[model samples]
Target chain A: MGALNREQKDMEEQSAKHKVVHYPQKKNKVKRNESLKSNAIAWAFLFPFMLLYVWFMLYPIIQGFFTSLTTGSFGMAREFSGLDNYVRLLSDQAFWQSLWNTVYFVLISTPTIVIFGLILALIVNAKLKGTTFLRSAFFMPYMLSISVMASIWVFILQPYTGFLNAILGQLGVSEEIFWLGNEHLAWISILVATLWWTLGFNMVLFLAGLQDISEEMYEAADIDGASAWAKFWHITLPSLKGVVTLVVILQSVASFKLFGQPWLMTGGGPGDATRPLVQYIYELGFIQWDPGYASAVSYVLFGVMAIFAAIQYKLLVKKEG
Target chain B: MSKKLNIKTVVYVFLILVTLVSALPFYMMIINATRDTKDILMGFTFLPGSALLENYRTMMEYVNIWNGFKNSLIVSVLVTVLSGYFSALTAFGFAVYNFKGKQPLFIFMLLMMMVPGQLGLIGFYELNRFIGTLDTFIPLIVPAIASPFVVFFLRQYLASTLHPSLLEAARIDGAGELKIFHTVALPIMMPAVATMSIFTFIGSWNNYIVPLVVLFSPEKFTVPVLMGFLKGSQVAQNLGSMYIGIAISVVPIMVAFLFFSKYIISSISAGSIKG
Candidate 1:
C-alpha cells in the first residue's frame, strides 16, 4: 500500500511539471494566431485602396504606354505603329522648341525661386516680432490658385496701361515693355510671375529644413568667434544639404511639368516662345484632337522626366553602401 | 565690430527689399482691385481707391462667382475628408500589417508618388470618359482621393509614431480590428490627419486641368476653372473687375492660411524635412 501511494505521488508531480511546461507554449500559439488575425484585418483595410490604385493610376499608366504605341483611331481600332511616332517627334520643331522653352524656364526660375525661398526662410527663422504675421503674408501667395495668380499678373503686366509699365513711367522710363507680347519679354514675365507665386512654397520648405538644425550648432560656432557669414557658410549650408537636394529635385520636377502658368500667361506665347512640352501636349490632345500624337508627345515628356528624376534620385537619394 | 553691425543692417535692408519684391504683386492686386478700370489701365495705383464696392458688384454680376466659390468649397472639403480617411487607413495597414507583398506594395506607392501629374492627364481623361463620369465633379474628387503623396506621408507617420504594441495589446484584450483602429489608432493620428487635410485641400482648391476637361458648364466650375474661363473671356479683359475676381479667388485661401499657418508650416516641415 505504501509503495502504491508513493508511485501515485510521483505521477501527480510529473503531471504538474507537464502542465507548467505546456502552458507558455499554448499562450505563444494563441499570440501567434492573434497576430495573424490582426495582419489579416490590416490587409482587409488596405484592400480597397489597392483596388482603387490599380484601377485608377496603375491601369491608366500602363494604358498610356500602350496607347503611345497605337494610332488611336477614336478607340475603334489600334494600328500598331512601331516607333513611328517617336521617330516623327525627333524632327518636330514645336516639340523641340517647347522643350527648349521649358528648359529655359527651369534655368531661370529654379535658381531665383531657390535663392528667394532661402532668403525668406532665413528671415522667418530669425523669430522676430510679428514673424507670424509676416510668415503668413509670405505664404499667402502659395495658397492662391495658379489661375488666379495668372489673371492678377496679367493685369499687372499689361503693356499699355499696365501697372508695371506705369511704375516704369513714374521712374522716367517712357518705354512701354510688351511684357506678354514680345517673345523674350513674355518668357521673362512668366518667369517673374512664377517666381512670386511659387517662392512661398520653397520658403516654407527651406524654413522647415532650417528649423531642423540644432540651435546648439549656432551657439557652438558663436563661441568659436565665428562671423555670421562664416556660420552661414559653414553651419547653415552643410546642414541644409539634404533639404537643398530635396528642394532641387522637387523644383526640377515642378519646372519640368510647367503647364498652367505658361498656358495662362502667354497662351504658349507670343508665337510659341513660352510653350512648354506639357502645354504642347495639351494643345495637341484637346485643341488639335490628335490623341495619338499627343499621347506620343506625352510619352516623350515622361521619358525626359523619368531621366531627370532618375538622375536626381541617383545623385540626391543615394544611400550609403 | 561696428563694421559687423553695418553689414547686419545691410543684410536686414536687403531682406526687406526682397520681401517688398515678394509683396509687390499682392499689393498691386489689392490696389488694382480698389481702383477704377480707368486707373488700372492708366498704371499702377499705390494708394487706396473707392472702387471696392463697385468692383465687387461688377465681379459678382459678371461671373457666377458665388457658385464657383460654393463648388470649390464643396470639392475641397470632400477631398480633404475622404482622402484623409483613405490615406490614414492605408497607412495603418502598411504600418501594422505583416502581410504578403507589403514591402513591395509600399515601394510601389513611393514610386507612384514620384510620377508627375501631367503623365496621367490624357489617360485619366479617357478613363473618366469611359467610366461615364465626364462633365461631373467625380472626376475631380475621385482621383485625388488616391493621392500617392498623402499615402506616403501618412504611411511614414504611422510607421514612426504609431506603436504596434498598443495594437497588440488591443488584440489581446479581444478588441476587434476595426474597433482597435477607430478607438486606438485614429486619435493618435491627429497631426497626420491635419497635415494631409491641408495638403489635399490646397490641391483640390487649386485644381484646374481635370476640372477644365471634365466640367463643361459654367455653373459647375470651381474657382480655378472659373478664373481660367474668366481670364479667357471678354470680361477678363476688363482690368478692374478682373483684378477684383483675382482678389476674390485669392482671399479665401489667404484667410484659411492665416488661421492655420502654424499647422501648415509645421506639417510641411515635418513631412518634407524629416523624410
Candidate 2:
C-alpha cells in the first residue's frame, strides 16, 4: 500500500519539528524527568498495538522464514534441514507451473486493468452528464467480495444454462461453450471477471490524478490547436505518471496474489491449469499438510513481490528525486 | 455546436452501453433469483417470477446464509472497532511523543506494510496452531489491532491536522496523558478513522482465506466462505437458489455502497495520494 519509500524521511522531518517545538521548554533535570514521563506514556500507548503487531505480523514473518528452512508439517516436530525446502523447490514442477501461471496473470491483468482504468477515468473526467452514475456503476463491483464476484460470473458463464451462452444463442452463435472448463477460456473468463471486479479502483485513482491536472494546461493545449489525441498523449499521460506507476505496482502485486477468483469459480480446475502460486501454497500447507514446503513456496512469492515492491520504491524515488 | 452535439450523443450511447454491460449481471441475478430453477435453466428472462420465496426456501433448506451474514457482521464490526481505536492510539503516540525507538519502530511498520499478506500465511497458520487459536474467530479478528496502513494514514492525518497547542491545552487543564488522548486526540482523529474503518470493515467481511483455513465449522463460516461453501453444496443444484444465494450476499453491500459512494470514492482518491 504505502509503496512510496520516503515515509521515514517524512516522519523524521515531523519528529524534528516536534523536537524543535518542545526543546525550548526546559532545563536539564526537569527535561530529563519530562522525557522519562513521555517515554513511559508513549510505550504504554504503543504497548497494546505493539504487542499484537509483534505477535501477529512481525513474529510470523520471522517464523515463516524459519519454517521454510525446516522439514515438517504442522503439529509435527520440525527437523531443521537448512535450505532443504528451497532445494526441493528448484525441482518442483508444480511450483514452476503455478508460479508461471501467477506471472502470466500479473503480466496480463496489470496492464489491462491500468489502461482500462485510465480510459474509464478519462470518460469520468470528461465533465459529461451522468458521469456520477457511470462512476458508481463502474465501481460498485469492487465493493463485493471476491466470492460474490466469482459467483455472479460462474452463474453467467456456466455451460448449457449460462446466461452468456443464452444471449449468444439469440445472436445465432449457439454452442455449448464451457467458459471455465477449457484452460485458455477459463483464464480469459477470470480476466474479464477481474477486470469487472477491480478496474474501478484504478479508475478512481486515475480520476483523482486527472482531476489534479489543472484545467489550464488542457486549455493551453487547446489554444495551441492540439488534437484530443495529442493533448492526451502529451498533457494527460505525463501528468498521470506517478499515479500510473503506483497503480501498476499495486495491481501487479495484487494480481500476483491471485487466489480467490479462480479458487471459487473453477476451484483451480482443469488439472490446476488456473492455479496461482498462492493456491499452490494453500494446497501444500493445508491439503497436502506440508508446512515447510508451503512456507518455501510462499517465500518465493514473497521474493517476487519484494522485487516488484523494490522496483516500485525505486520508481517513486526517481520520480520525486 | 450541432456536430459537437452529435459526438456527445454517440458518447452518451456508448456510456449507456457500458453501463448495461456493467449492470446487466446484477439485474439478471436479481431477476433469476426470483425464477424457478427449471425456468432459469430453460432460458434467461428479464421478468421476475413468483418463485422468490421458493428459491429462498430451497437456499435456506441447505444453508442458513443469515447465520453466515451474522458471523461476517460480528467479525467485521470487531475488526473495525479494534483496528480503528488501536491505530488511532498508536498514531497519536507517534505524533505527540518523542520517545525511544520511535523513528525506527514507525519505519519498521511502514516496511512491513509492503510485505504481501500471503507470505505469512503458512507461518500464521502454524502460530495459531501453536497457540491453539485455530478453528476460532480469534485469528480472524484479533490481528486487526496493529493494522499498519491505518496507523500510517492516521499518523499522517494527525501530523497535518492535529496541533500540539491543543494537546498542551488539554494537559494544562489537568487532564492525564491518556485522558488527553481520549478527550482531545481521538475526536480529532475520528474522521480519518471513520474513512479507514469502512475499508477495515469491508476487508474483514470479505476475508475468506484465513477464515477458510481456520474455521472448519459450518456454523462459524463468514459470508464469503459460506458463499464458497454454497457453491460446493447441493444448493448449486438449484440455479435459482444459487443466484439468490449470491444476490443475498451481494445486494446488501451494493445498497450500502450506493449510500456511501461519494465518501468512499473520495477516500480512495485521498488514500492513494497519501499512500
Lowest-scoring 10 consecutive residues by lDDT in candidate 2 chain B?
A: B159-168
lDDT against the true structure, per candidate, is: 0.78, 0.87
| Maximum-TM-score candidate | 2
Candidate 1, residue A267: Cα displacement in angstroms equals 0.9
Question: What TM-score does chain B of candidate 1 reach?
Answer: 0.94
- All models, DockQ values? 0.47, 0.66
lDDT of 2 by residue, B108-157 (tens): 88778878778888889889988999888999999876899899888887
Q: Which digits, one per residue and each the tens of the lDDT, describe model 2 over residues A1-321?
A: 233345545666767777876665657788879788889999999899999988998788789999989987788898999999999989988899999999899999988998899988998889898898789999998888888889999988998899999999878896689999999999999999999988888899999888878999989998999999999999998888878887887798789889998998888877889999999999999999998889999999989888877887787646655
| Docking quality tier of model 1 | acceptable
How many pairs collide in each candidate, listed in order? 0, 0
Summing lDDT over every window of 10 consecutive residues in candidate 2 chain A, give the lowest-scoring window: A1-10
**TM-score of each candidate structure, all chains considered together:** 0.91, 0.95
TM-score of chain B of each: 0.94, 0.96
- Among these predicted structures, which one has the highest DockQ? 2
lDDT of 1 by residue, B1-275 (tens): 99967966786786677668767887788788898887777666579788888888877776878799999999999989988888788877766665556668767777777787677777777788789988888978777777777876666666556665676688789998788889988888878888778878888888877788778888999999999998888776566788888887777777777788887877877767535
